[model samples]
Target: MPITNADVVAVFSEIADLLEIEGANPFRVRAYRNAARMLGELGRSVRTMVDRPEELDALPGIGPDLAGKIVEVVTTGSCALLQRLRKELPPVITELLKIPGLGPKRVRTLHRELGIETLAQLRQAAEQGRVQSVHGFGAKSERQILEATGRLLQQERRYKWADMEPVAQALLADLHATPGVHRAVAAGSLRRGRETVGDLDLLVTAENPGTVMDRLTASEDIQRVLEQGVTRSSVVLKSGLQVDLRAVAPASFGAAWLYFTGSKAHNIALRKLAQDKDLKLNEYGLYRGKQRIAGDTETAVYKALGLPFIEPELREDRGEIEAARSGALPRLLQLTDLRGDLHAHTKDSDGHDPIEAMAEAARAHRLHYLAITDHSKRLALVHGLDADGLSRQIDRIDEINASLRDFVLLKGVEVDILEDGSLDLPDAILGRLDLVVGAVHSGFDLSRDKQTDRLLRAMDHRCFSILAHPTGRLINERPPCDIDLPRVVRKARERGCFLELNAHPARLDLSDAACRIAKSEGVLVSINSDAHSRLQFDSLRFGVSQARRGWLETGDVLNTRTLGQLRSLLAATMARGVGQ
Candidate 1:
C-alpha cells in the first residue's frame, strides 16, 4: 500500500531527531529537519515524487543524498542505513535520546556503565543513586531527570498554543525595547498563529547590527546565547524557548520581516511566482533584472506579484497565492466586526465576576450582548450549575436584561460533552437557555472515532448553539484530542451548529488550518473569547487574526451579527435539530 505524506514526514522527523542525538553536524541535521517540514506541508504525497527524482532533488534543502533516501524509503518501506542504525541501537537508547538534555555520548555512558536504556530504567538508576555516581552525572543532572520525568508523566505528548503565547509576546516586547532596535516583531510559528510554537523568531531592523547583537546577548531574559553574529542572534530564553533574532537595514526591513515571518511553504510559493516572471525575491527586496522594487511593505511585495495583499494568517501556502492571484481571497473577519461574545463565565461557576458585573463589562466594551456560559453540573469542582441552578441563572439574566437598557445578557451554559457522546444537561434545561456551548472538559484521551462521535452527538442536541474550543487545547500544555476536525465541521454545517474560534491566548482553538477547513465546509464559526474575566475580552483580537487566516468573512461568523440578529439565528439553529 502507498503510504501517506504524513507517514513519510514522520519517518524523516524521527531520523532527524535520532541524528541530533548522535551529535550529527548541525547543518546536516537541519537539512533533514527542513526536508521533513517541507514534506509535511506538501499537498502531494511523497509517492508521487518517487518516479521523478529530479523533481524531489529540486525542492529546497533536498540534495542528492536526501533525495536518494526519499526514493529508497518510498520503494522499500525503509532505508538500509536507518534500519541498520535502529537495529544496532537498543530501543531504550533510542527512546532516551528524546530527553531534552541527554545526547548520544551520555546515553552511551548510561547504557554501558549504569545499564540504563529506557527513561524508566534511567529514572530508576537516578533514584537508586547509580546515575549520580557516574563520571559526569551529578545531583543537578539527577534533579533535572526527575523534573523531566514528572512533567512527561503529567501531560500529553504535544504542547498547546496558549502555553507559548505569553512567552512569545514577552520576548518580542523585550527585543523591541533593546537599545538601537529600530523595529521588531515576532515571526514564524507565532506570526503564523500556530496553536503550538516549536521556537520563536524575531525580525529586527537596526542601524548597527553589531550593537543589537551585543545587547541581545547580554539581555537578562536570555538563558544562553546559542549563536551570535552581525546579522543574526539566537538565544534560549529561561522558559526553554529558542528565539532567533535577525537584523537588517531599514530599506530591507519589510522584505526581511516578510521573509522571516514566513510559513516557509508560503515563501517558496512566492519565489516560484517570482521565478515565472524572471524576478528574484530575497531578504533584501524583490528584484527584476537586478532592479530593486517593492521592499517597503508587504502590500508592495504582493502587488509586484500582481496579487492582492494576503493576510499574515492566510500565508500558509495553502491555496493563498492562487486565491490572491484570482482576486478571490475571502473578505476575512476582523475584531471590530464582532458584536458579542457567546461563551463567558460568571460567579455562578468558577468565574470571579457576578452576572451583573459581567454584563456591565460587556456594555463597557460596547458589545451588543454577552452570554453567561458558566460550567454545567458535571464539573462539580468548578461549581457547575445543576438544572435548578441554570433555571435560577435564567431568572437572573431576565432581571439583568430588564435592568440594562444598553446591552442584553443571554442565558448560556458551557455544558460538558460527556463520555459516550451524551450531554450533561438534558433538553428541558437546554431548551430554556439563550445559547448552549457544548465542550469537552475531561476524558480527552478517547479514541479518534469515539471523540468525533461524542462531538457529533453533542451537535445533534437542538440547544447546542456552538461548539466551544472544539479541540480543547491549551497551548504548549495539552495536545488536541484525536478527533477528526473535518468530519466535525461537516456535521456542524449540516446541523447549523457553529464552530468556535476560541479567543483565549492559550486556546486559540480552531487553529488557522482547522478554521479554514471549517469555513470551506460551510460551517459558521463563533469567534468567542470564552472569557472568565473582563480582561480576557482582548483575546478576541487573536481569534480575529485566526479567522482572517482561515479566510472567514464577517458573514461566516455568528458573533458578527447584532444582538437581535444573533438571537434570531440561534432560534433558527435550535428549531432545526432534534431535541436532546
Candidate 2:
C-alpha cells in the first residue's frame, strides 16, 4: 500500500519528541515540529507530492533538507535519522511524553534525576514522593502526574479517527470492488465516529465467500493473516490495525451490520427487546421459531422491534432505545446545517493561508459566513495580533467584505483570556469587532475552582462571544483541564455567550458530552473549523460527527443560523448594561 500523509507526519512528530528529550538543538527541534504541522495542514497527501520536489519545497515550513526527508519517509517508509534517535533513546522514554503532565523537559528531568524510563518507574517515584523533589514538579504536580499515569496505563492503544479514515476508506473500496463482493462497510467504533478506533470491524455481503476471502488475504496491505475461514477472516494491516472481515449472505447483511456496528450495551438491550417480543435476534436475522421476521434491511429490523431506526451514532445505549420508542429521537445535526465557521485563523497569526484565501475556501466549502478569529498578542510564538494589528485587520476585512458577494467575513479575534481572567486586547479594539472568541492558551494546571472562575470572569467581559475550545484538550496529546464543565456550560447560558466545538483534528474540544450539556443548558455551540489553512475547513465534518454524537440538532448550533439571525444572537453576548 502507498504511504499516507498521516504516516509521514507521525514519524516526523515522533522524531521531534525524541529529539526534544535528547536535548537537541532548539531550532532543529522546531524544524521537525514545524514540518509535521506543515504536512498535517497540507490537503493533499505528501505521498502524492513526493515526486514533485518543487511542490514539496514550496510548502511554508519545508526547506530542501526537510522536504528530502519527507520524500525519503514516503518512499522508504522510514527515516535513518529518526531510527538513530530511537536507538539513542529508550522507546519507553518517548511513551512517557504521552502522559498529560509530562512534556519533554519533564521527562528528561525524571530520567536524569530519578533514572525513570517507564511508567511503572514513574509511578514508583510519584508514590515515593520522589517526583515532588524534582526542580519543577511540586506535590500537586506530582499528584497530577500519578493521576495522568494511571489513566495512561489503563488506556488501550488506539488510532485517531483522522488517521484511520483513509485506511478504512481504501480497504472498504477494495473490498467492495472484489468480483464476488456485493457490499462492504466499516462498522463498530468507526461507524460511531469515536475519537479513536481500536480495530476495524468490516461487514461484507458476497456471492462467493471463498473468492472474497481469497482477495482479502491476498491484499498487499495485510501484514499478517490472523485467520481465514469460509464465512469470516481476520487480518492485521501493516500499521498494526487489526481487521475482522465477515462475509455475510445478502439476506443477513442488515443483521450482520447491526451486530457488528453495535456498542455492546446497545446490542444487549436490543436483544432483550427482541426477546420480549417473543423473538430471537442474532447476526443472521430476527427469528420467531425458525421464521425470519426481519433481516433484509436495517429499517425493517428496527421497525420489527417497534422502534424507529436509531442512527448509528446514537446507538450508544444512552437512552436512545427509549427515545426511539417514544418518538423523541432528535433530528440530529447534519453537515449541511452548518451555515458558517465562527473560529478561523489567517496568515496574520500562525495560520498558513491569508484571510482572503481562507474566506474563499470556506465559501467553496458551502459556508455562508466565516469569522477571521486570529490569535491575540498573548500567544507570542504565533506572532498573535496586538491592538494595532487587529485594527488593521478589521479594516482589511471591511475592504474585503465590500467586494464579496453571497458571503460575509465576520471581523473577529481569538482573544486570549489572560491567566487572571482579563481580555488580552483592550476594550477599545474588542468593541470594534463583530465578536470576540476568548480562549485559555496557558495556565492549564490551575485548580478546578480557579479555572472555572477564570472562564466565568472572562464570559462576564462585555465583548466575550464564544468560549473557544472549551476544556482545553489536544485529543490524545493532552488531557482536558481541571475546570468544572457543567458549571461552565451553565455560566455560558446565563451570560448569553456560546461555546465552540473546535473542528481541528488536534483539538476537537467541548466533547460530545459537553455539547450535550450545552444543549440542555440552552447554550448554543459553534461547530467551528478553527481552520489554520484553507484545507482545514474540511475538519468541520469531524466536528459535525461529534455534534451528532452529542445529539445536537440544527437549532442547538449557533453557526447554523443565517447571517442576519446570527448577528442578533451575537449581539446578546455583548449586552452588559452598555458598559465596558
Candidate 3:
C-alpha cells in the first residue's frame, strides 16, 4: 500500500509515546513529534519521495537521522527500533499515555505500582481507594484521575455547525433577555462563518457590565464559571460548551463586535492597511491620531478607510482589501437572492418532516420553489426511495403543486454515486426527475486518482445536475477527501453541472477556495442547506456567507435566478447534452 502522511504521522506519534514512556531525552522525543507534524502538513506524500531522503531533511525540523528512519519505514513495512520497542512494551501501557494529567512517568507508575493497563482499570483503582493509597497519588490526585477519566469517557466530540446552532441561539436569547443588556450578538468564529466553532462567543452591549456578568455567571445552564471580570466573563455550559460574553459600551459596540468577529488574518491585513494610511484600528474603534473616526458599524469603519464595506465572511485576508480598493468587489449573493432550495429531505427519506410540512416551511421563508431531493435506494438506513417510491413522491409533488397557487415543489433525487462513479438510479429512473443531485456516500478512502475519476465520471451522467458537497469534509473532524477540487470544478463547469456549496456547517464542502476557483472556471454554484430538518433551513445564511467569501454573485448561483429562469437553464443544459 502507498503510505499516506497520516500513516507516517501515526507511526511517528506511537514512537514518540514509547520514547516518552521509556524516560528518553525530551528534545529527542520533541524532535520526532515535530517531524511528524511537518510531514502531516506536507502537500505531497513523503513515501513517494522516499528514495531521496534529503527531500525530507530539507523540511524545517527533519534532519538526516529522521529522514533515514522515514526511508526505512517506507522501504519496509516497519522500523527495526520501533518493532523492538513494541515487543518490549505492552501496547496497553502505551495507550495510558493518551489520558490527560497522566504523562509517561505517571503512566509507568500506574502500570508498575497499581498494575493498571487501561483507563477503565485506572478508574476502578481510583474509585476503590487503591489509587489514593499509592505514595504519589493522594486523595486529590485520585479525584482528579476519576474526573479526567469521566471526561475522557464522556467526551461528546465537536459539534457540527448544524448541531451547535440551536445551542447558540438559546444562549443568545438568554443573553438578550438578561437585565441591563442593551443588545447581544454572536461574534468570533460563529460570526466569521467557520464550519466548526471552538466555542460560542457572544458580545453584549450592556448598561451595567457587572450586573450582566453576574447574571450570566448565575445562569442555570452554566456548568462552571471559568473566568469572570467586570467587562468580560467565560463559562462552560452543562453540555460541554464554552461561551464567552464580553460587555461593551454602546458607543464602541460596533468596533468591538467587528474586532471579535474576526478571521484573525483578515483583521491583521486590515490593520496593516490602516497603519499605511496613517490610521489606527483596534477593538475600541478606528482612530486618526487621537480622534475616533468610526466606532458604530463595520460599514462606517470600512468607509473611514475609503472603501466600500467588506462582508464579514470575505474578511479572511484573501485579497478583500485590494478588491475593495479597486471598487471591483464582486456583488456577493445574499439570502434574499435565493429563489429556491435544491437539496432538502422530507419523510420520504430519513427526514423528520412530511412533504407538506417541509413545503410549508419553505413557503414561510417565502422561497419561490423547493426541491424534495430525498435519498435514492442505496441509502437503506435513510429509507431511500426506489423507482416506485420516487414515482409516488412525484405524484404527491404534482398533487401539491396543483393545489398550491404559489411556491412550486420540484421532483428531485439526491442520487448516490457508487464507488465506480455510476448513479444508484439508472438513466431510466433519473430521466423522470426535474433535478438530480449526485453525491458520494461511501468509498471515501479511494486514492486521489480513483476518487477524482469517480466524481468526474458521475458528473458526465446526463441526469447529474449538481455535484453535492464534492469533497465530503466535516470541519475539524474529517479532512477533504483526496480529490483535485479545481479539476472537479472544471469538469462540472464543462459538463454544465452546478457544484453545491453545502451550507450545513460541518460539511462546507467545495469550501471558499473551491468556490472561487469554480466561479473563475465558469461553474455555477448552488448555496444549499442540505437540510434534513425544518430548523436547519436557516443554515442558508452560512451558505450565503461562504458564497460571498468566494465573491459569488447572483449571476454565478443557480438559485439566484427566478423559478421560471432556473427551469429554462436546466432545460438549456439538457438540450446542450442532447445536441452534443
Candidate 4:
C-alpha cells in the first residue's frame, strides 16, 4: 500500500497526542501538531516528493526531523517514536482526547491523577463521580465528560471533503495519465459535494481495463485490494477511505455515471419516471427493451426523460425533479461568482498573515474586495483588538487600499457575541467599519432557548452584519450547540443581517440544511473562507461546494455583490437604520 498524506499526518497527530499525555516537552509536542496541520493543508501528496526529501523539508513547519519522520512513515507504515510512545503510555490514552471537554492538559490530568486511560475507564471515573475530584474538573465537568464519551462511542468514522480533496485530485491526475485512457472522473457523494464522504468511486472509459486495474493495485496508497476483476476493482487506501474503480465502454459512460453518481432517492425517482414511459434506465443505458437509447451523455439522458439536466450537487432528490420540470432549477452559485470575502482575520489577531500580504493574496485570487475581521478583545488569548488597536488597523487598511488598484480592504471585526447577548466591542468602534461579523466563540453549552435568545439579541444590535459559523461545529470533533436555527435564520432575514457558511474544513457551519433554510426564508448567506492566513483563502472553494449543495444561487450570497453593493447592504445594519 502506498502511504498517503493523511497516513503520515495521522502518525504525527498520534505522536503529538501521546507525547502530550506523557507530559513531554511542549515545544516538541507542538512541532508534531504543526506538521500534521501543514500536511493536511498541503495541495499535493507528500509521497510525490519522497525521492527528494529536501522539498519536504522546505515546507512551512517541516524541519529536518519532521521531514525524516514523514519519509519514515510513508516508507514504512508507522513511525518508531510513535511506537515508543505507545509502549510508554496506554494504547487507548489517545481515545480520551476525543471527549469534548478534554484537551491535552486535561487528558494528562485524567491519566496521571486517576490512572484513567481508556474510554471505559474515563467513563467509569465520570459516572462514579470521581472525575470531579481532579483539580480543574467539577460536577458539571464530570457530566459533560460522561456525555461526550457516550457520543464518541456511538459515532462513525467519516472524512471531511477537504481532507479527501487533494488525495482524490492526485489519483485522478494519475489515472488520466494512464496509457490508452479515454476519460476518468470521480463520482458518488463526492461529485454531489457532500460535506463529508465515506469513500470514492471512479468511473473510467479506457481501451485497456487491465492497464487501469494494474495501475490502481500498484499504487503506493493502496493498503490492499479487496477485490479485482477485469473491469471493476476495489481497494482501501492507507487513510482508510475505500475507492472503487470501474472501467466501462465509452458508449455507456453517461449511463454508468448516472447510475453511480446518485443520491439513492434521486435515482429511484429517475427510474420511476423511466418506468412510467415504458423505458428502463440502468448502468448499461436507457432502453426501450433490447435497444439502447439516450445514453451517450448526461444531457442526453435528461433530455430523453423530458427534464432539464440537474447539476450533480442537486442530485439529492429534494424537490429537484419538480423544479427541473417547471424550469425553476437554480443557476447554482459558482466559485467565480464570488466578488470578495467578508470574514477573515490577520496578524492583528491570531492570524498568521499581515494585512497588506492578505490583501495582495486576495487580489491574487482575483477577489475585488476583502474584509479584515480580526477577533475582538473578548478573545484575549488571540490578543484580539481593543478600541485603539482596531483604530490603528482601520487606518492601516486605508493606507493599504491607497496602494492597490481594483482591490480594496474593508476594516472589520469578528466581535464576540457575549454570554448575555452584548457585543464584545463598544458600538463606537463597530460603527466605523465597512462591516461587523458577530460570532459565538464560547458559551456553546447554553440551553436551546438561551442560545437562540442570545443570538436573537445579538441580531438586534445595530452593528451586527453577519453571523460567523453560526452552528459552531468542528466536524467530527464537536457537536453544534443547542439553538433554534430556524428562529435565528428568520430573525436574520428580518434584521437584514446575513449568515456565514465558514469555508474552513473544521467548521463548515450554517450547514447545507441551514443554507437551504436561509434561502427559503429569503435571507442571504455569505460564503467566507474565515481565513487566518493567505493560503487559507484557497479554502473558499470548499465553501462554494457547500453552498452549491445547499442549492444557493449567486444572488443568494451576500458577498457575490460588488463593493458598492456590499457597503450599501452593511450600512443598513448600522444604528440609524435599525428602525428603517
Candidate 5:
C-alpha cells in the first residue's frame, strides 16, 4: 500500500511524543508536532507529493529537514529517527502520555521517580496511594490519573473519523473498480458521521461475490484477513482498523444498508415500528406474510413504515423517528448552506497560510466571506497578536478588502478568555473588529462551576460575538474540560451571541449533543472550519455531518445567513450591554 498522509502523521506524532518524554528541546519537539498536524490536515497526499520536494518544503512548519523526514517516511514506511527513539525509550513509555492531564513533563517525573513504565504499573502505584507522593502531583491529580487509567484500560480502541478516511476511500475505490462489483458504499457510524468510528462496515452489490472477495483480500493494506467467503469478508488493516465487507443482491442492497448503518437502539426502534405495522424487516427485505413489500430502497422502507425518510446522520434514535412520524423532521444542514466561515487563522497566529491565501482558498471553496480570527497574545506559542499587532492587521484587512471583488475578509481576533472571565484584548481593540471569538486555552482542570462562570462572564462582554471550541477537547487525545454546555447555550441565546462548532477534525467541539441543545434554545450555531491552513476548509464537511447529527437545519446555523443578515445578527450581539 502507498504511504498515506495519516500514516506519515502517526509516525511523526509518535516521534514527537517519544522525544518529549526524552526531554528533548521544546523547539525540536514542536517542529515534529506541527508537521504531524499539518500533514494530517493536508488535503493532498504526501506520497504523491514526494516527487516534488519543493512542495513539501513549502508547506508551513515543514523545513527541508522535516520535509526529508516526510519523504523518508513515505518512501520507506518508517524513518530511522522514529525507530531509534522507540528503541531508546522504554517502548511503552509513550503510552503513559495517552492518559489525560499527563503531559511529557509529568510522564518523565513519574518514570524517573517511581519507575512507572506501563499503565498496569501506574495503576498499581495509584491504587497504593503512592502517585500523590510524587512532586507536582496532589491527591486530586492522583485521583484523576487513577480514574483515567482505569477508563483507558477498559476502553476499546477506536480510530478518529479522519484517521480512517483515506483507507476507507482506497477500499471503496478498489471495490468500485472490481470487475464484477456493481456498487459499493460505506455505512454504520461512519455514514452517521460519528466523531469516532469503532469499525467500518461496507456494503456492496456484485455480479460475482468471489471476484470482489479475492480483490479485497489481495490488497497490501490488509494486515490480516480474519475471514473470507463468497458473500462476506472481514479484515484488519495495517492501521489496526477492522473492516467488514458484505455482498448483497441488488434487490436487498438498501435493506442491508439500513440494517448495517444503524445504532443498535435505532434498529430496535425501527423493528418495533415494523412489527407494529404487521410487517417484517431485516437485511433481506421488509415483508408481510412472506411477500416482499419494500427492500430495494431506504425511502420505500421508511414510507412503508409510515414515516418520512430519516437521514443517515439522524438515525441515532434521538427523537428523529418521532419527528419523522409527525412530519416535523428538519432539513439538516448541508455543506453548501454556509455562506461564510467565521473562524480562520493565518501566519498572524499558528496558521500556515497568509491572510490573502486563506481568503483565496475560502473563495475557491465558494464562501462569500472569511474571518481572520488570529490568536491573541495570550497564546504565546502561536505568536498571537497583542493590541498593536491586531490594530495593524485591522488596517491590513481594510487594504485587502478594497482590492477584492465580491468576496470579503473580515477583521477578527480569537481572543483568549482569561481565568477570571475577562477578554485578552481590551474592549476598544475588540470593538474595532468584525467579530471576536472567545476561547479557553488553559485551566482545563477548573471545576465545572468555575469553568461555566468563566465562559458565561466572557459571553456577557459587550464585544463578545461567539464562543470558539466551547468544550476544548482533542478527540481521543484529551477529554473535554468540565463545563455546563447547555447552560452556555442558553446564555448565548439570552445574550444574542453564538456558539462555534469548530470543524477541525481534532477538535469537533460543541459536539452533536451541544448543537442540539443550541438549536432547542434557539441560539444559532456557527459551523466553522477553523481553518488554520487553506486545505482545512474540507473539514467543514465533518462539521456539517456533525450538525446533521445534532438535527441542525440551515436556519439554525449562523453562517448560513447572507452577509447582510449575518452582520445584523453580529451587530446585535456586539453592541449589547451586560445582562441585556
Candidate 6:
C-alpha cells in the first residue's frame, strides 16, 4: 500500500505525543507537532516528494532530521523512532491523550503521580475518587474525566474528510484503472462535504461486476474483506475505515449515486415527494407503473419530481426541499466566487513561511489580495509581534505592495481577545492596520453569556474588522466554547464587522449552522484559509463547501468582493466604531 500523507501525519503525531509524555525537550516535541500540521494541511502529496530531498527539507518546520524521518515513514510505511518509543512506553500511554481535558502535561502528571497510563487505569482512578487528589485536578475535574472517558469509549470512530480524501482518490484511481470499469466515484457523506465521515460508499459502472470486485479485494490497502458479491462488496482498510463498493448498470448509475449519496432523512423526504406525485423512486430508477421515467441522471430524477437539481452539500433535509419547491434555493457560494483570503500568517509569528513567500503564494492561487494576520505579543510562544513589531510590519507590507503589480498585501494582525472583553494590542497600534482579526486563544471555559459578551466587546473595537474562528473549536480535539453565536452574529451586523468561516480543516469554526445564522441576520462572512503556509491556500475550497452547506450565496460571503469594494466596507467598519 502507498503511504498517504495522513499515514505520515499519524506517525509524526504519535512520535510527538510519546516524546511529550517522556518529557523530552519541548522544542523537539514542537518540531514534530509542527511538521505533522504542515503535512496534514498541505494541498499536494508528500508521498510523491520522497525522491526530492531538498523539496522535503524546504517544508516549513521540517529540518534535516525531521525530513529524513518523513521520507523514512513514507517509503518504509513505518518509522524506527516511533516503533522504539511505542516499545519503551506503557503501550497504551497514548490512549490517555484522547480524553477531553488531558493534554501531554496532564497525562505526564497522571502517569507520574498515580501510575495511570491506560484508559482503564485512568477511568478507575477517576471513578475511585483518587484523581481529584492530584495537584491540578479537583472533584469536578475527576468527574469530568470520568465522563470524558466514558464518551470516548462509546464514540464511533469517524475520520475527518480531509484525511479521507487521498485514500478515496487512490481507490477511485484504482477502480478507474480496472479493465472492466467505466466510471467510479465516491458518494454518501463524503460527497456532501461533511466535516467527518464514518464510512465510504463508492459507486461504479463496469462491464464486468465480478472483475471490479476482484480488483477491490486484491488491493494492498485492504485489511480484510467483509463480503464479496456480484454487484456489491465491502472491506475495511488498514486505517480502520470501512468502504462499501456497489457496481451499478450504466443505465441506473445516476439513480444509484443519488440513493447512496443520501442523508437518510433527505432520501426519505424525496421518497415522500415521489409518492405524492404518484411516481416510484429507488436505487434502480424513478418509475411510473414499472416503466422507467428517470434514472440516468440526478437532474432527471429531481426534474421528474418537479424540482430543480439540488447541490449535494445542501441535501441535509434542512428546508432544502421546501426551498427547491418554491424556487427559493440559494445560488450557493462556489470556490470561484472567493476573491481573496483575509486571514493568514507568516514567520513574523508562529507561522512557517516568510512574508514574501506567503504573498507570492496568494498571487499564485489567483487571489487579488492577501492579508498578513500574524499573532499579537500575547501569544508569546509564537513570538507574536508587539506594537513596534506591528508598526514595522505595516511599513514592510507597504514596501512589498509597492513593488508588486496587481496583487496587494494588506497589513493585519490576528490579535488576541483578552478574557475581560479587551484586545491584547493597544488602540493606537490596531488603528494602523488595514484590518484586525480578533481571536480568543485561552479561557474557553467561560460561561455562554460571558463568552458571547467577550466577543461582542471585541467587535466594538474600532479596528476590529473580522472575528477569526469565532467559536475557538478544533474539531475532534476540542469542543466549541459555550457562546451564543446568534447574538455574536447580530453584534457583527450592528458593528459593521464580519465573522470568519475559518477554512482550516482542523478549525472550520463559524460552522454551517453558525453561517446560516449569520446570513439570516444579514452579517456577511469572510471565508478565510487561516493559512499558516502557502500550501494551505487549498483550504479555502473546504471553507467554500462549508459555506454552501450553510446555504450561503455569493453575496453572503465578504471575501467575494473585489479589493476596492472590500476596502470601502472595511473603512465603514473602522469609522462605525467611532460613532457607535
lDDT of prediction 1 = 0.78
Best by lDDT: 6
lDDT of 6 by residue, 1-580 (tens): 5788999999999999999999999999988999999999999898888899999988888888988998898888889999899997865788898887789989989999999988888889988999999999999889989988888778888888888878888889889999978899999999998988999999999999999999999988789999999999999998889999999998898889999999899999999999998988999999998999999989999999999999999999999999999999999998989889999999899888888999999988989999999999999988999999999999999888889999999889999999988999998989888899999999998999999999898889888899999999988778899998878888999999999999999888878889999999999999999999988999998899899999999999999999999999999999998421
Clashes within 3 Å, all models in order: 9, 0, 0, 3, 0, 0
Between 1 and 6, whose TM-score is larger?
6
In model 5, the Cα lDDT at residue 544 comes to 88
lDDT of the candidates, in the order given = 0.78, 0.88, 0.80, 0.87, 0.90, 0.91
Q: Cα deviation of 190 in candidate 6 (Å)?
A: 0.5
Q: Write out the backbone clash pairs for model 3.
A: none
TM-score for each candidate, following the candidate numbering: 0.72, 0.94, 0.69, 0.92, 0.96, 0.97
Write one digit per residue (lDDT tens) for candidate 2, span 1-580. 5677888888898899899998999899998998787676566777778889999888877889999999899888889998898898886688788777688998998899999999988988999999999899899989988898888888887888777777787778788788877898889999998878899998888889888888889987789999999989999987788989898888888888999999999999999999999999999999999999989888889999998899998888988999999999999999999999999999999898899999899999999999999999999999999999999999999999999999999999999998889999999999999999999999998999999999989988988999999889897888788999999999888888899998777787878888889999999999998878887788899899989989999999999999999999888779851333
Runs with alpha carbons beyond 4 Å of true place in candidate 2: 51-55, 112-115, 125-142, 217-225, 576-580
> Candidate 1's residue-wise lDDT over 449-495, tens digit each?
99999999888887888999999876644668899888999898889
- By lDDT rank, best first, the candidates go 6, 5, 2, 4, 3, 1
Would you give me the overall lDDT of model 5? 0.90
> Where's the lowest-lDDT run of ten residues in candidate 4?
571-580
lDDT of 4 by residue, 553-572 (tens): 99999999999998888887
* Candidate 3 wrong stretches, greater than 4 Å: 1-159, 533-536, 578-580
Per-prediction RMSD in angstroms? Answer: 17.8, 2.3, 18.7, 2.8, 1.8, 1.5
Report the lDDT of model 2 for residue 210. 80
Ten contiguous residues with the weakest lDDT in model 1? 156-165
Top TM-score hit: 6
Clashing pairs in 2: none
Candidate 6 segments exceeding 4 Å error:
578-580
Cα lDDT, model 6, residue 227: 99
